[model samples]
Target: MSNGQGMATEGEVQEGLTVEEIAFIHGHLHDNVGELILKAGKFKGLDVKKLAAQIQSRQKALKKLPEWSTNEKLIFPPALSVEQCSSEATAHYKASIVSGDRLIDITGGMGIDCYYMSRSFTDTHYFEQQPEVASTAAYNFTQLGATRIHVHAGESLHALHDGLNADWLYADPARRDANKEKVVRLADCTPDVAGNAALLLNAAPHILIKTSPLLDIDLASKELQKLKEVHVIGYEQECKELLFVLDREMPEQDFKIKVRMIDAAGQPIHELDFDREEERSAVVSYAKPLGYLYEPHAAVLKAGAFKTLCTRFNVQKLAMHSQLYTSEEYVNDFPGRSFRIVAVCKPDIREISQHIPGDKANITARNFPAKPEELRKKWKLKDGGDHYLFATTLADQSKVVIVCVKPI
Candidate 1:
């Protein structure tokens, strides 16, 4: 139905799931959806397709949103939303960073961030363009006893245009275009956060934007002149989200970049804060293969801390371009994977075999021409073993395979 503003709202979400449907969903929560669909005819008077979708979404949520997934009464949205929604680990991280009297999430897709963030604020407003999804989130919030969050079904920009203001403004713009293709640039995303930076700052002094990990932090900072902090967040060694915090009052020229690595339990593993000037001005020493090798975590690498690693960890860089680090004395507290060097030699298969003396070894290519698989095939090495081989270029611009083993 048309909302009379040239925008068509989807039909109101189902008032509620039927008792039988709920029962079916709970009973088959752990069942394989494909298998259940195969035997759909066995269940009478049940919407097998609908229940199957619910089960699928809930199954995904069990790991991503463990807190809410355990409550059988809470309904789930479509599989895409469940997959795209922020994991409990990241949501908790967002909530811990900012708090205020009033908070507004303009691009509230499934309300995962909004719900978690609401706990830190007195009042939270969630706006979503999709009517059905918004209503579903509202129902879920009620079921989860999140009374502090208020859901509004409409375009987020329209909500802001209508004089809605808050102490903190948050947005996780949709990365998909009208054709359902993924986009990386902030301007291409829905809500056009880059274009409306001024408007958003007018609505709220502070704004937090969650963007795709592929986005360049430097480019984004340049786009949003009021950028305050760039948080490069990693979950379980994978870069999950790039959060940019903007403040109207803070000067844009002196923004800081932070890299945080969190475990699956939403606990911090390692965190480092540095500025571009520090990274650029830091002195880094280069050395050949050393006793220990350290590889920075994904988040650290994504934040472009190539030379900063040396200054921060007191390690030597393998090469100017190679991200691998080395130290004569083992640095047990390194932020990324650590390895003890076993042997360093040419990338020749004969030399590798002489050093490894095994058929299988973990292969990693850093600043090397060949990929892991190509090198693996050429060197006749299998995928897994206690041995870890880093085929990288040394400081002298010579290719070498540095055989390493995990410290026991």
Candidate 2:
């Protein structure tokens, strides 16, 4: 499998790290990179910089790509590649979406997604424009015993132009540009997925496009006329990826959105699925602070399921725009954090102290006039305690501080 560049391809590139380099990386895996750089001269004839980078990347992988991180035989890519690559959880989730005889990854950066997704297909084609990156990924696939993935070191569009077809096509376009500035628009991304939608649909029945979390799902869905589904994924309370699945035969304006939040241990804590029409037609009740307060996870919020959440969980919103929910009875299966309302008081320190005498609580401001930091200063409250103070507006348009405690 020559990469067709005349330069060294996967079959002919340097065969991963040298034994000495591997040993050095494994030995200093827990050491600080800066210290290792300072000791570079003492360790002669070693690519100290590269070794340090591998160590850092491995450290990060311990959490993001645990299975890969433990395999010493696999050569890690540069830090940026590791950072940009999808986590093991996300990659596996993607693999579960579609499966067939043939698959193609048009923007295979580190080949993480391709390697995992290839399990569901008989064969997978990985195309990367960067020769060196593609070569390293090819070597890694070999080390991981992924014999079904074929590496193509060139422009992805060129590969498609060459008449490569598949049952499924995948792409995670580079979100950052040549200048390293982050871009959120599909057109700004490398390979211009939006512009090449037709070519992709012609190449495969299904096309899965992964974009930055900052992407506007509704806008992107409208942009990609064949969009069939959108997935908003969150990890560690932060939105991470926006996945759009396109089908050649799918009808327009009929896409559904799936929002999921994964905890630190890579376990999904909450998941909600709804379409735009469902959201628009859903009705939610409103009320003052009740016995329990619920805050939906980042993914659900990003997916804009405010009304759906209310109807689904039988809860009431504090206000139309508050995005905070309340229920007289606790909903154990609610998708977000739950707290028992201790007291609802006026936004005065004296009234707040009457309930929260300790003056220590985790403060969150939702649809409030002041920021959390500013409120913290004005109320003379220390951060971090079992108590949580929510300063938000009620249905009657009155601001109040709701003190809450985690339900035992």
Candidate 3:
């Protein structure tokens, strides 16, 4: 498989291949083994048509591997998985700056989001700390005919500190710890939120920070002064990451705080509105679960509209467990599905150990101050069960347990 210009050699076919060759392989190879061989044989120029035929021939004898797909239908780079790409795309789309002429992405991982957002801006600057990633991005941009884009390899904060100006700054901070552990909170990462925020906000009028799905929105919002928007994204009702936007210049009237959960097609699955003047306390309380239970969408939870949600759904709060609410009437128009509470307990370890006498149990602890894994371990519970035990805290500072099942 050699071309005229130093194309096909044994080493090239066996080990070294250019990115263009890899892209060809990705498009033609159907199986993981074929993909691996093509990746290994990178230096050589593999025939795309031949590889496709080879893949078709090999498929007859090979066992099928698990195929991975996402509800978001996001297309990812070969280096990243579909889930990661979908998540990054959703966050970038939601945090997009429509008013910006020039945009700067401080941490462009695979150039997926950068490619999508660059369409709205006149010019785009993408910075990647890793040399390989930066090179890949440069090649990809050139191949895509994106002449107005520049890919730089260096530290983002240092580059920003050197005086880069843009209408918007987007950053995805490294959330990995020193021990190579994944951390969810702002305090967990290197150059923490404050440090990154200082550099990012200094470069642009608006900065968008993408955070973990497990992060505490209240805590994150409290940490950033100019935080104007918080979004909790979801794909097909499954909660994903939380996005925070901080604006340097305030609008004439503060934009109403919005909580939006979007689907794979970039449609709003659920939305909740909040203002600076809205109260965070629990609102109206209805009688115990009568016909249905309404769980607010992620955006609603991020907005901390416990009272507003309850009022909107005509539900009652289950004390202080802000994660859940109860109602008697069936509100078909509610964003979240309705569930029925079958039982409630005090969540005493002794009571739980004594009352539950089964080989399998489904344990979920929310706002009750106990970790789910710890509770599951302590209770010796297993999965694949119909019952859901909710260990949550009440407004009275009391820990309680509620057993629930999906409503018919």
Worst 10 residues of 1 by lDDT: 1-10
Error of 3 at 244 (Å): 1.6
Residues 23-75 of candidate 2 have per-residue lDDT tens digits of: 99899999999999999999989989988989988987888998899888677
Ordered by lDDT, highest first, the candidates read: 1, 2, 3
Model 3, range 1-408, lDDT digits (tens) per residue? Answer: 111111111122212334564465455446565455556555365654444443443332122111111111112234322234434337445535444678888877766567667767787888777665566556555555566677776676777778978988776666665464555467775446554666677789887777767777766666665787776666555566667778887553344556666654456756766664564454566343344555666556655676777656666776655467776666666666566667667776566544455746677676778887887877677764766777876666667776666776
Model 2, 216: alpha-carbon shift in Å?
Answer: 0.9
lDDT of residue 241 for candidate 2: 89
Worst 10 residues of 3 by lDDT: 64-73
- Rank order by TM-score, top first? 2, 1, 3
Cα-based TM-score, every candidate: 0.92, 0.92, 0.65
lDDT of each: 0.85, 0.85, 0.60
Model 1 C-alpha lDDT per residue in residues 1-408, reported as the tens digit of each score: 122111112355436678888888988888999999999999988879888998999998888888888877677888878988899899889888989999999987878888888989998888877777777777778777788787778776776787889999999987555575545578777678989988899899999999888887887777786888999999976899999999999954689998989876556789889999999999999999889999899999999988888998899999988999999998887889999999998988887887776699999999999999999888778899899999999889999999999976
